[model samples]
Target chain A: MARAQWPLQHGRPIIEIVLTLAQGAQKVTRRLLADTGAGAMHDPFDIVLDEVDCLMCGGKPSKMVPLGGSYSGTHPIYVIPIGIPSLGFRDSLFAVGVAAPPAGFDGIACFRFLNRFTYGNFGNANEFALET
Target chain B: MATATSIQQLNRDLADKLVEEAKLDLPSWPLGKFVGIANGHVIVVSDDLDEIVSQLERAEPDPSRTFVVEPGRDYTKVCEIWRIS
Candidate 1:
């Protein structure tokens, strides 16, 4: 199984993923909140990014997303590549650009993103992983 | 871009205004076209995001507080847009 696992660094199951934003540039890693209850079919966003990060990464919107919950407006969506080194997984997915990201995360990995893999501790409650 | 520093320190009121302002003007443009706004003013309105950004680069030197969006797409509901603040 292709799996990427990490301990709950902030007492939460956050994942360390790298974004391939600029070619031949420094590796950009972002810690995202693994929110299993944070997405719906209406929401095409698989992940989230703050405006600065999004723009710095040259994130451009292919779609307009209306996010409910703490965010309430139409935001930009980008198809950015993500890498989970632990799993040796690299692929691109939809990311939403928002203004006020939560307090403790660079971004969020919503259910839509997680649904792509089999994720959980797989037995170790102190850690998390994406089993593919 | 680090969670160690929250974007809450930014001008949230201005950010909200930009998005709201863009939404209000969405109908005036063609569907599927992209719109870019920055510093509380509409900067680039074009057919795609690339064109918008290209025009935006010259229009707004500092686009850290900009908003870009497209029309005629599905509405996504974020059950939780936040982690634990």
Candidate 2:
């Protein structure tokens, strides 16, 4: 089981997270998931992946590239230029985008692969239940 | 030139603008983000305003990450765009 430690603030969850990548892991927080969800935010797919690595297989990914001039800030986001074998691997490569991130890692799950999973928000914790 | 009072005031103003204009369910806090405000409202990406606001509220000073949202500033549309690059 995987867990994340969050802060406890007046018995409310105060973090923003998203769960696009489906992984089976226990969530832990010092406070509560509610604190993370006081407003809209990205899912914590990386944190969840710490425990449950997505075991998906056999999919054709489109070739996408990032525009050199297109940038959000000074930070540089990287993505795979060519499609690679997704199956027989721990985590599959999906589409990448340059957008605002939530808390944990700045990687956003692509909607193409994300369509294969279900999501839930238990207070401040956001979960993605992927199709195995 | 910003005192605690000024921070408090800015926080309140941002909270009000976020609620009234953006139509987002934001919690009241002293944290701040680089919000892009055009006409009294914070500019934000269509699907990420909530995530940005929540992060602003919780993220603390960490040496691992460089970019950090300060407290009492507005982060409307002018935010870091994340995509598969």
Candidate 3:
């Protein structure tokens, strides 16, 4: 199994993601925050993307879904394929389109996406990684 | 009159207004496309956010009141996590 790792940004995990869109694949070299707490169980949104990023990346919402947490509302849900080359991970995942940013990150990688493999620093406090 | 449209300071009320305007003739709009609204009217509709912004700026007189977004029941609130630390 391949392993992919990245440095902690001010104590937060900033992971590199490649968004494969109809236009082409765009590498978000280091933009998405790896937040296991992003979405709850049963939530299909594996990532949270602001409208601008969603549109620029050519992500079109396949359906409109409701979200409840710090705020409660129904939002557009998009399907997009994301890849982490280092870990040899690639999958088609669902994402939510929002007007506001998810925390301060360009995007948020949630539980469904991160839980697919074993993830943690693995004793290396300076960095975090995923093992497939 | 001010020219140039922009999608900033977007509040729920404004978002609702845009959605309402778009819903007036949803039959003509394509699926998965974002709609730009300004001055309580639909400005442009496209899948590209940059194109929406560019067109809004060129067509609308007040860009500050412009907003481009998907006309769906989707919304997210931006607020700080309660910090007692």
Candidate 4:
């Protein structure tokens, strides 16, 4: 079993994880936020990515639709290989991507990814742990 | 099959490199805009999501190897927990 832990900041759980999108010999990586709340399946999307990131990562815009929340109008969707790494744990999965994510996050790690781990926070220590 | 362990290590390497590069590049990026990185380069920076996406498609065709980021903000800054009755 692999496990990793991150410290909480200002009463919030923040994890430093890398996201990778690879094609052949080309690969791009970005640090992203792993949100326990943001992990809900948005009907058709497995994960939500910033629109600009989606395209740069080679995700093709499929369609635009209302996603509500901080987003308005239709948003672009893309199919891509999304990789996540944290502490000593890492994995990549094929998922649908949405261009519109709330400001301040490169991307959101939702249930599609979070379900793979047993996670919890230790407020006394100001840390959170994710284990597989 | 790509095991979780292998993927995790690969992603860690990629993320470390990305963070390292961003330290040098992010200082010059325009604030309050989205930035996209592909092939280890800053490819796009814009406030318009559509425009950025369009540019990325033409520039980087492989979505898997691309990275996108927002500068100068903490990941937890805007997170909100809501309660519904």
Best by DockQ: 1
DockQ order, best first, reads 1, 4, 3, 2
Candidate 1 residue-wise lDDT, B37-75, digit = tens: 655456676665456666655765444544455443324
Sort every candidate by lDDT, greatest first. Answer: 1, 3, 4, 2
lDDT tens digits by residue: candidate 4, A28-49: 6543455655534323344566
Q: Give per-residue CA lDDT, model 2, range B1-85, as digits (tens).
A: 4554454345446544544543343343333233322222233322333343333324421111111122232333232223223
Q: Could you tell me the lDDT of residue A93 within candidate 1?
A: 55
Candidate 4 residue-wise lDDT, B1-85, digit = tens = 5554553344335535544565577775444455555554567777654555556667766544444444432322232212111
Superposed model 1: Cα runs more than 4 Å off: B1-73, B76-85
Which segments of candidate 2 are over 4 A away from where they belong?
A1-91, A95-103, A121-128, B1-85
Residue B79 C-alpha lDDT in model 4: 22
TM-score of candidate 4 to 2 decimals: 0.47
Of models 1 and 2, which has the larger DockQ?
1
Write one digit per residue (lDDT tens) for candidate 3, span A1-132.
888888886678867777744355546542677777676543546777776666555553334556666334677665455678877776655667778755656677777778877889989988978888
Residue-wise C-alpha lDDT for candidate 1, range A1-132, written one tens digit per residue: 788887886788877889755435567889988888677643557788886776666554344667666678778776455678878877655688888677878888888878889999999999988888
Residue B43 miss distance in model 2 (angstroms): 47
